[model samples]
Target: MKKVLSIVLALAMCLSLAACAQNPKESTEPSDSVKPTEEAGIYTPGTYTATARGHEDGVQVTVTVDANSITDVTLDVSKETESIGGAAADKLKSQIMDAQSAEIDGVSGATETSNAVKMALQDCLNQAMGVSSDEKTPVADGTYSGTAPSFGLTSQMTCEVTFEGGKMTDIQVTEESDSATGEWFASAQELFIPRVLESQSLAVDAITGATTSSNGIRNCVAAAIDAAGGDSSQWYTEIPKKTDTVKLEGYDVIVVGMGGSGVLSYCAAAEQGATVFGIEAAGKIGGDSVCTYGPMAINSQYLKDLYNNGEDYINADDVYNTWMEYVGSDEKADVIHEAVYNSGSALDYYVDNFGFEFEGMGLLGSFVVPEWTKLWCVYSADDDNTSWNILGPNKTFQFTRALETANAMNEKNEYMTELTATSLIFDDDGKVIGVNAQYYDGTTYEIYGKTVILATGGFLGNDDMMNEYLGSTVSTIGDTVNDGTGIQMGISAGGATYMMGTLPMVHISQVPHLIRTDDLTADQKAILTALALTTDQKMITTEGNVWGNENQSGTEDEGITVEIVYAPDYMYYVVYSQEDIDNIRTNGLTEAQANATSQFLSQGGTLPAAGTPVEDIDQILQVGEEYQNVIKADSIADLAAAIGCDESNLTEALGGVDTTYYAVICDSYAYATVGGLDVDVNMNVLREDGTPIENLFAVGQDSEGVCNADGKAYTPWGGQAQSWTFVSGQIAGTQAAAVAAAAE
Candidate 1:
């Protein structure tokens, strides 16, 4: 009887729709005698709420369903990335309503959040259909393959899962990208993959500094679980953490970081017979250093013999003079002198004793002046590629070699990963002693040592500290785990800071959440890259104002860095028209004007050749729209409305918009923070009153400001920061080792 009534109701509804269409002006409201059918539609009319795992936390979806259609949908993706996932709410909601079902093409760039919304909405719709909620899906005993977005939003990390007797037996990552630091990704694979299998859960903590890769692996497993007919959410079982305390003592020197600087410090201290304890907040040893190309060297024997026939490639005297001139002051002249003169010698010492090697000499991406000396040298890698393999992945193995060499020098020398230094330990006279740290699993550690070196890379990862010091925050490509604990520890020990508000190392610009090369073909990626970099058309900031030299806040007179750093939201948009698209399809991109290279976007593809027409121009635009990196409209008014800006301002910026228009977004990313704790020539932390903290030292980004000025650009050389690590780390380690010996 129920089935017969459902069929009759469906036939009557079709007839009523036909009658309404025939009589256009007829009232469609039901009469009093024709009562509306209750509980007869496919779906039980009600709102349903469901939750699914997002990039970081649970994404809640509330869906309203009427008797026959999806009435409305809403999402709460607050825990996702603000500019990426969080920005896709409206689009996702609109997609759900338009499809009238959970079947929807998700937004690009925010793939994780989009997938979560789809899964949660599907659950809600299933509830509306009166599906049994008490029953759980059984996992089929078979192997399955799945994928998820990894480091790059558009890149995929694939994994194969084996299921036996309704339990996951093994998982093997079939493919992964090295866009995230290679060492960090390896660390994630080494630690994260096994924990999931051991716990039989997806709630394991992500490896520090390798969160993206860890999440990628977890999501891949979750996808495999779903494919095997099991509820992925059921595996998000919480794991308990132990709250215990541990104490470690008898170390002569403690290094509170394991990146380029901290590793060098440990090696230098260990060479001096000082027992060293190294603490790293990340899962791996190399932090931002793993992603860097190389470091600056003056007249290192390798560069001198290979490039300039053993004499000096460049004079040290000129470097020191130019360095002082760049800062426009002699405030930290002593430290600057040490940085310039000792850079080569420090690198030589590491090469001779610590097994470090530099293959060739070249210029860095962020050089100050074209005519200046090519002081930077590339770190040697296994395979030779462009620029002496310095920019390749194998260069990170050099740090590994250094750490191994250091450990062999002293049996007591040790390093711990996933341990973060919380604060400095002080003695009765308020003198710095050791450090207080916390393990990732909630264990407390109190480590004592005679001297401490602060080298936690800068505080670019700390939002509050960035706001407190630099007054603004930018997208960082550096390790987000390198908070300001080292600098704060220095300050707690009466150490002052130098140029705390200096500009960051902002060198690269691309579309927000850059789509990886694997996601787009060479031609499509070339077109997108061209759209982002083309200055042929008028460009405007997020606020609808024309972007020009007048908007630059950089202290540098001329450079792309200044323009990008000062742009609104650190981004701008290039407006194109239907005519522009037609031109691109017919003729070609303004190849010369559009060839500005963004290393991140051009990783695995080449830009279209000049005058080579891009036939897939429209397809590329569609992709840009999907990624929310492009805005398309039919008129100037629509463009303004879409961009959320005033039409008048946009008109003034672009003169006028005619026909359909597309606005392509361009965003900037930074490497790390520039300024940090003040230090003396010997790399000892200095108090506000110009006195040195006897047992405290700062290096790398923590003391980088000693060579830079606030409000001005970083010492425009790319390898300068890496060079400082060697110089400052060596000086600090040697000085601290001497202090420890004297105390004994």
Candidate 2:
């Protein structure tokens, strides 16, 4: 139960307790279509006893009503669970007054409770709305147990209904999912006894979305009626409201993940002057921002800010244009326009006060953006050279600046702890208040806070996750260290999911060894070795047939593709030699043929590995069977054939290779996949019906990745590790803060 509440609250996207413009016929025909024969105005609203309980304890409620609305409501049961039900109770009363049943909005903290209450009320309303109360047969009115399915998931509950002389005079306590709202729902039993006794029959409502609890409660009543063997249910009845609240321990805000987005959210909240606690999922503090290589793409106004002391900085428009040119995709949303138009001052504020870096050299200024995005810069391997450090002549400084800003915020907020937030806890009112952290030693530490921002780096950090969701049967080409634990936990909890397929992390490294031992195709191996000589180039698709567009579904697998880095031999199991790789890095090789001569000496030993002399290759230490996945070819087409690519495109791209861009490509790094997730602009995780989860918010990778297109791509986009981590985190933290503050 502890695990469910904490984890489920964060990942609460599965439930759709609220309905908007829904087709009522989807459930049942509306009873309201029939006309009331006995002047409906003369009917006096009656009280209906109700019992709602968790699997453990049950609560009783005495609900009193007049006419069509509830007048007085009281909870006669519930002890330990009362504190968490305030919001649910308030919303329940409000809903009964203005709206009756399934037509109401979902309660945040008391989601299940509100739904159950609505259903209980609907049971009575359905009867009152019926044209002939006597014609309404008793479909259910007893102590019965059943399971209700919602969001493709199911929950179980128990119900007890009572009927005496035809009308329902009493209701008994039963089970509910919201262990907290037990008293409020159960209290209806007492106040409703008189009405149930007087009426000939009564109709009741079922909980909205919580059909299980609703059915359980009604079944309890039904069982009581069946025990009496009477046809009951024809009077008006209502459920009580929740009015108490439960608050968590210290701190106003808790931010999950610590990469760029997490940092930004923390900084923003701290800037707004709130006491905040920053939580991370990994053992380290830096999510993905710290590992970035270059400045992020910015708009023109940002460029204007850096011009003040122009010794070095970047231009925002350039970032946009460069991205469009390189990625050759049209998805960029005119960041230049927004930055140039509305974000000038904001850009200046970030740059001047936060020390945000801006790069303007190399393609850093003229760089092209990929059609896809994950959250990092795509270029800048030259930074390792003497010419590209933060202050170097060729280097522009945006990445370091952002990190500086985050650290500064941390410094200012001494109370903040960088704990990994494994789970989130929400009060019954449907507001987030606390979180759980699992330490490296496998111990879990609980943190109670007002709000939390998820900035955990994307799923790229976890090896297991990569294989589970991504293609990791082979070595992962990107940052092997990126695992994305925070994102996984966040998603599993209902925080919502997004952005997983950004830059494709080539999954196999020692693939060749897997041939007989692990299973790989011949062509899959040769292409890998052939491409091994270039920069960080990943074979994402084979002629665009298998993965149409870019793995939007992450379902299809065409021919094999490889993610090869530009080492002496492309990023491969074995480069002939470090010097040979250096030669490719320096652009000194005469021809592709010339390069193949010593391929054997460059990397792994013989066939037991191919291309190299067995003795010379064997000299290098090796373990399992021969390296089998490596590829070798004299021409691009041959190479293309081996790697499962468009032979024609490879031939063309190789004919007149751009030495400047292709030179010395280092390996790539992947933080998480950013693809499809159902969400709204407010960063709210929504049901297919478009209603928000009360306390649920998502930030960082799992949440962000879902919104982006599948097979998203990023190039050395700085913070590629935590690209969306910064922005998405800001949205979650701020909103979570708003919800918490409102709850308080």
lDDT of each: 0.76, 0.38
Q: After superposing candidate 2 on the true structure, give the runs of residues whose Cα lies further than 4 Å from its correct spot.
A: 1-248, 300-302, 305-348, 358-418, 429-431, 441-443, 473-485, 489-496, 499-531, 534-590, 593-671, 676-679, 712-726, 729-734
- Model 1 scores worst on lDDT over the 10 consecutive residues at 1-10
The residue pairs that clash in candidate 1, if any, are: none
Give the best candidate by TM-score.
1
Q: lDDT, candidate 1, residue 115?
A: 62
TM-score of each: 0.83, 0.42
Q: Per model, state how many residue pairs clash.
A: 0, 164
Error of 1 at 446 (Å): 2.4
Per-residue lDDT over 523-638 for candidate 1, one digit per residue giving the tens place of the 0 to 100 score: 56656877887767778887889886667775356444435776765678888888888988888878554575666535445666667787888888887786677899998888
Give lDDT for model 1.
0.76
How many pairs of residues in model 2 come into backbone collision? 164
Q: What's model 1's TM-score? A: 0.83
